[model samples]
Target: MLDTTGANPFALSYNKLMDVALLLRKYLPHMVSFGMFARVTDITPKTVEELKNLHHLKLDSINIGIETAHDPTLERMSKGYYAFDILEQLSKLDEAGIRYNVFYLNGLGGKGNGVASAIATADVFNQLHPCIINIVSLTIFPESQLYQEVINGTYVEEPEIERLMEMRTLIDRLNIRVNLLGHHVSNTVPITGALPDDKAAILREFDKAITKFPEKELKAYRSRIWHL
Candidate 1:
């Protein structure tokens, strides 16, 4: 229940006085038991410290959006920080002994650099070792810069199977253990598991479908799900 965007701007700033009256009146009862806290990025480092002061505040988890490990891809996507900067922030969070979840976008490196992006991302996650890693495929939204690229033929979306393969490959290479959650609407097949062990098996299942299943049968299966 961390609010990455809120008044305090950093998770550590949460305190009794910050918004005591309203929080107590509205959220305290439901949140107290689960240790809910919000993470606010887009704030200065100094402000981040102010937020960290609330460590005594009970929070089950904090979530942050790291986006991508490739700097160029992040720049193209107009994200605020570089890959190293994200790593540093995650390191700081780790040092504080705060559990966190990280969000990453798939197919962001487009065609040529997808593998590189995947590998770089795995390296970062392996280092940070967040409690959860949420892998999501890119969906073209009309207002986004990425959408413009797709419209102009500058960027192409990979087929669902290809995207799954890329993620599977990346997960296969990770050395650390973290829960992987891929339940976004853009993902054709939802996957959830801890790394290294389940990754290869899931990938193999998808590979079999892509390689052996007839297109007609696959379409029928997809159609049934869609209709249901």
Candidate 2:
């Protein structure tokens, strides 16, 4: 039931289940776990309600990519929607009784604005209170504007240690109880736990690294090709 259309709302092929769901229904066991990808942020709440039928088929999870909380960053990334739009769509999903995970990116704004981007993203996650929060560090792809800027000497990459410090600050400030998943390769250090328990310990690890690790080593630790 994963909607593998990336983040495009209009990319949805139909209002209801397509042939894939039918095929899965035909061969898969009734109680088997299933998940789907959908850009809940870009579509109207009505479109999300259509997914209510998924419960009839026994869907276990859904994942949405809520890249950043800053509207300008989203527009620059071409995510096709604003932060509030995503919040509205997530609320609708909750009302429909569908469980979902949200993905957020750190260091997306690069050096100058990276810290603010992390803070804004944390605010959104606290508000949504999703089942899981997947945090990933920003990576420039060869085909993306970020990549071009890097090649042309216009983009200065953020050090891995600074990024980790920003993330540590974010983790320290989160008030909700959702699980934090930092398993992505872009992340310099990956740890998972319920907030306010291991949360302080996790942030402490990064804080120590910030003070102990040298600039070059930190940069090397943070550089990676994976997105999430």
Candidate 3:
């Protein structure tokens, strides 16, 4: 479920999604495949169980912008949820046999914490077995609070090369079988492959970025990106 407004769909009512699901199943019975973007904090055991009852509707896929499993980074960005919440909420989905794709915001922990962020995020993701881990490098726009933080010296954006290293670290530590989608517009290098199979090739690409590409070139590419 994609929300263009970036608001949590179930923020208002836990039953809202179920209500919609019922309508879809009744009116459009042919529509079986379904996916939606949802916040883990907004999902409950009841929501999963209720959806499971609708065996005819294939609402088995979900995309969650988990961002980072690092608590300090989550709080710094004001994500309104914590690491444990990710574990608890997602476990409900796992139990209900729902497949999910998650977003991993590279450089979310800022300059010094990039590696740590990757390790922490990978730890959480490994347990859940996400279908895809979408890797996006954090980009701070002028109007964003993060931009203000950067201006005020409260936060430091990760160096482009470091961001690549962070992504490599995440890939290296991931023990689960999942797709790593790094083709987002925010990424400097578009890398897409499955883990444990393309692991070596993926690491090679990251190594090339870290060694072959000049930092200035990567920075220039980043500067050209105005939005996510």
TM-score, one value per model: 0.74, 0.82, 0.91
Q: In candidate 3, what are the lDDT values of residues 38-141, reduced to their tens digit?
A: 87776754555664653235667778988999999999888889899998888877877777789888988998898988889889888887889998888889
The superposed Cα distance between candidate 3 and the true structure at residue 50, in angstroms, equals 3.3
**Candidate 1 lDDT:** 0.63
Number of clashing pairs per prediction, in order? 7, 3, 3
For each candidate in the order shown, give its overall lDDT on alpha carbons.
0.63, 0.70, 0.81
lDDT of 2 by residue, 102-134 (tens): 877787766766677777777776776588888
Q: Which candidate number has the best lDDT?
A: 3
RMSD vs true structure, all candidates: 4.9, 3.3, 2.5
lDDT tens digits by residue: candidate 1, 149-188:
8889988765555665667767776889788888665556
- The regions of model 2 sitting more than 4 angstroms off are 1-14, 18-23, 41-45, 141-144, 222-228
Candidate number of the best TM-score: 3
Clashing pairs in model 3? Answer: 1-35, 1-36, 1-37
Ranking under lDDT, best-scoring first? 3, 2, 1
What's the lDDT for residue 145 in model 1?
78
